[model samples]
Target: MPKMIFVNLPVRDLAASTTLYLALGGTLNPQFSGEQSSSIMFSDAIGVMLLTHAHYGVFTKRPIGDARRDSQVLLALSVDSRDAVDATLARAVAAGGRADPNPAQDHGFMFSRSVEDPDGYVWEIMWMDPAAIAGTPETA
Candidate 1:
């Protein structure tokens, strides 16, 4: 069986956060969700567990930092093409995400853009050409 990844994040408002994630193309998984936490399935292999701050605290003794002020993680997603990367970023912004301050990258072989979720979590969208891996000496 293939390994699956579940990213757990602390959220201030469960409903709002769930809405945002849904808008960003995640499907709700009620089997693993509740009033205190929500399971947002991005794909068959990728699931994001959004836990309310209070519920999140139950899992850790340390205090949670405000992601808006401090970034602890950057989640990245790979798409099939350069256009897909841009399109996904656009969907994020349209869903109320903040665009990454850094400009999009166009290395011929790879292209990428980033957007910050409403909770201030960064999500990078990228696409890499298989041919570029072989053609680019820098990659070699």
Candidate 2:
């Protein structure tokens, strides 16, 4: 297998986090997706490992900062269309999550929305039409 990246995110409640992602067009890898932590399969290689705070602490001896209080990381994913972004945020809201305050970044060619998961980690869902992107050298 080629090199892959897995974003490890700490959550107060693993079960809730799992459900939230599952609602947003994500699948679970039973091998790694379980009670304590789950491998949120976005595209096989690019997966989000949502581990409970207690479970995550086992790996990191340091205290886990509260994401709600402090921003530790920002998660972003590029999609094929703007509708995909709205769909994801809609599903997130239904799954007990909230969309961030920022409005969608629609620059004719590109569109994006930043949402805050229930646990407060930010995620950016964006769509860029290649033709539009190619035309805009600055966006390139």
Candidate 3:
């Protein structure tokens, strides 16, 4: 199998963050999850490690930046269709997350929406037309 990707994010509350991820359609991988952290499986190749601030501090010397005040990273995930993108955002809002302050994006062949999880991490949910991507002119 190819290598998988794991996004480690620090959160204030592990249980609340875990609930938000579960509502986003992610499965909890108990093997790597515990009271201080949660391993959320978005797919076979993608996983998110939600760690409590204290637990997360063990891995870094710098202070944990407050995502609500500043942005460190924007985690984006590609979905199957425009409807799926909308559905995911809707689910996010219903699960105690907030919608993006920016307006919805519609770029002809692509559609996107953003949401902030309970911990203020931004997640970009997007869908793009395969044909449109394939038809793009190549540059040297």
Top candidate on TM-score is 3
Off by over 4 Å in 1: 132-140
1 against 2, candidate with superior lDDT: 1
TM-score winner, 2 or 3: 3
Leading candidate by lDDT: 3
CA lDDT of each prediction against the hidden true structure: 0.85, 0.82, 0.88
**Backbone-clash count (model 3):** 0
TM-score of each: 0.85, 0.88, 0.91
Q: Candidate 2: which pairs clash?
A: none
Worst lDDT run of 10 residues, candidate 2, spans 131-140
Candidates 1 and 3, the one with greater lDDT: 3
TM-score-wise, the better of 1 and 3 is 3
User: What is candidate 2's TM-score against the reference?
Assistant: 0.88
lDDT of 2 by residue, 1-140 (tens): 87789888888888888888887777898998777899988885788899988888889999888778887776788777888889888988899787855677888788889777778887888888888757666666
How many backbone clashes does every candidate have?
0, 0, 0
